[model samples]
Target: MANIKIITDSTCDLSSAIVKELNIAIVPLYVVFKDVSYRDGVDITAAELYSKVNKLKELPKTSAPSPKDFHEVFKPYIDNGDDILYIGLSSRLSSTIQNAKIAANEFPEGRIKIIDSFNLSTGIGLLVLMAADFVKEGLTLKEIFARIQESLPKVKTSFVINTLEYLHKGGRCSAIQSFVGGMLKIKPIVQVVDGRMILGHKTRGKIEKSLRSLIELTMKDKDRIDLKRIIITHSEADEEAKLLKKGLEEALSPKSIIITSAGCVISSHCGPKTVGIIYLTK
Candidate 1:
């Protein structure tokens, strides 16, 4: 049995294959549309959520799992005599991390450790993966925490939102901004900075130019790129994701790049046609 167990929520947006391969435990969040609610990843998948989001007249809403949810997921590992390390979405974006911390406090001392990733989607997933790797390498809990802390500032994420309607709906931006931006066909380039989402730049001309700008921002520090570890996540925008990947490869020529779909929770906030780039820097 492993001495330490790694846990994360569905917001990580990691694939089942990767989770299984890494032997990591994931707790699911909930997505609600009107009176209907479903557990993320368990009751509904990215594909299903995407289809629903596209067809529904109103945008879907999402909620973080409660303390009870984290308690249930953590009990088994604790009962098995294994210490648990739970990583979660950014506190700036969700209360999931706070709930996980509360749940951890309910347990006996030294039994659980909850980490706020200060990131979202594959950005958070990248940090979770790094923690999992450290645990798999037989590192102590303290060592694992230290490594994650060190990598926090080095994790660079940048994205381009195809439309600002969802951002407006979520009250992250004004409706007038969305209206004017949408009319102009402006693509907003955003990034995760200091644990909160911030607008980095706006590309007004064309999609290609916007994409190029995103790639350039991500590859700004060519000397510090961690090529072997990078992730690109998109919300029903495979073509743009692919084009961004190719552009980044040609520019920085990273060691590897893994592309995957962003989950419903993230998609709910960013809306469809959102493309993100995540990388670990030295």
Candidate 2:
């Protein structure tokens, strides 16, 4: 092995068990509400954030981890003489990767490598796991980097927003538009395209209809899917996510399916009841 250490941001939506099992390090971002700041995964959790949002009737603002924060996380690894690989959320979505780059410059040139996952939630988690797999194969840093770079474009990150309240509050849509959409129960399918969230299809009626529409869209080109692994992630949406998982299991029959909750960063933006299926396509 190459004495490698893997680091990722809290937006990866990976569980504590998996992070510990993989021996991965996570640098947390910040979620600020009512002038109080909480570390993404450390101080705040998805359910707590959502409860506050509903109680306060406002969405929290999220900030990327500072370069100094990354330095703190990188220090122990560098002192141990281990080469560090930090996979971060999209530069376009948040400045997490850019800040990591700034922190990496504080150390020796080849000691740290920062990868912009160009993804969020478990989509980034999948990429982190992929890198860990390559590490177990005894690949050098150079080889691992090459493999990761190649796999970046294949990572699919997306979600179905159960409500547009946050979107309207964020001014992504007009109040009247949101009011009308909410009245009609219009759920928008949102996906990461070129590192930013874009509204995809508008599915009307109940949330279940939108989820089925999402599954249909996912399996429309089922033949091209890798089917090796799939992730279903949500924000305060256990039953809805499991329903999506049920359909996906019947359709793709992936080798493994992982379900997890969105972390502070993801939950801050998407609000509650946001669910999505993330997978790689061949």
Candidate 2 lDDT over 1-282, as tens digits, reads 439999999999988999999999999999899889999889988888888888998888889999999999999989988999888898888889999999999999888988888888887999998999989989988888888888888888779998888888876778987898899899999988877788888999888999999998898769988888899999989999999999999988889898988998888778789999898878
lDDT tens digits by residue: candidate 1, 163-211: 8888987788988898999899988988999889998799986677888
- In candidate 1, how many Å is residue 279 off? 0.8
Candidate 2 steric clashes = 0
Index of the highest-TM-score prediction: 2
Error of 1 at 194 (Å): 1.3
Worst 10 residues of 1 by lDDT: 50-59
Clashing pairs in 2: none
lDDT of each: 0.85, 0.89
- Candidate 2 regions exceeding 4 Å error are none
- TM-score of structure candidate 1: 0.95
